[model samples]
Target: MIRGIRGATTVTNNDAAEIVNATEELLWEMIRANDVKASDVVSVLISVTDDLTAAFPAQALRRIEGWTYVPVMCMREIPVPGSLPRCIRVMMTAETPKAQEEVVHIYLRNAVQLRPDLSLTRKSEL
Candidate 1:
């Protein structure tokens, strides 16, 4: 089946370093949680909050082992009032045997508030 793993994290600043590091952390946690292999991943879609214009979240994938060939798309999220700032969100589509309910969604930092129900794990608590 084709499954989607979701992850989101808030960067401490607008710097490219912060964005890349936080995104890498988030993706690592998500991959570990889902027991996902790079070969199983079909594509990755990344979205950043309007306030986060320093870097593309997908750029972090370049540093990740075995993910060089995976396709990635990046976009800017809509800025709604009271929305979280410096937030980066990712949706990874992959072929896996796990069911929807068994899939793990990750949320870290201030982005945890964005999906309390869907986010079963937090990096800070790990």
Candidate 2:
């Protein structure tokens, strides 16, 4: 069996380093919460707000983790009026023996405002 874990996070600015850092933080949390390993990850799909083209969050993840061979794709998040800016979101599908209810999803930083109850864990598990 397998499950999908969706996580979202936002940066306060468009700086490349900041975007990478924030994205790294969010991704690490998601990976940790679900106990995901390189081999367990089926694929990682990432999207970023229109205002944040400083770098691709997916590339950032690959660079930091040295997951050069992982399947990673990046797209721009639709720009909607009054939407959160400088945001990076991910939909990760992994090969797991657990059900959806057993997988931990993460939503962090200002994105936490989207799901207060599901916003985080003391584990920084996002």
Candidate with the greatest lDDT versus the true structure: 1
Best candidate (score: TM-score)? 1
- Specify the poorest-scoring 10-residue window by lDDT in model 1: 117-126
Model 2, C-alpha of 103: deviation from truth (Å): 1.2
Where's the lowest-lDDT run of ten residues in candidate 2? 117-126
Tens-place lDDT digits, model 1, residues 23-126: 99999989998889999999999999998888888999889999999999999989898888889999999998999988889988888898887754444345
What's model 2's lDDT at 116? 73
lDDT of predicted model 2? 0.80
Q: How many residue pairs clash in each candidate?
A: 0, 0
True-vs-predicted CA distance for residue 48, candidate 2, Å: 0.6
Model 1 segments more than 4 A misplaced: 120-126
| Model 2, runs deviating above 4 Å | 64-66, 120-126
lDDT of each: 0.90, 0.80
Question: 51 in model 1: Cα distance from truth in Å?
Answer: 0.8
Q: How well does candidate 2 match the true structure in TM-score terms?
A: 0.87
Clashing pairs in 1: none
Candidate 2 structure quality by residue, lDDT tens digits, 69-109: 77989998888999887778898888988786678778887
For every candidate, C-alpha RMSD to the true structure in Å: 2.1, 2.3
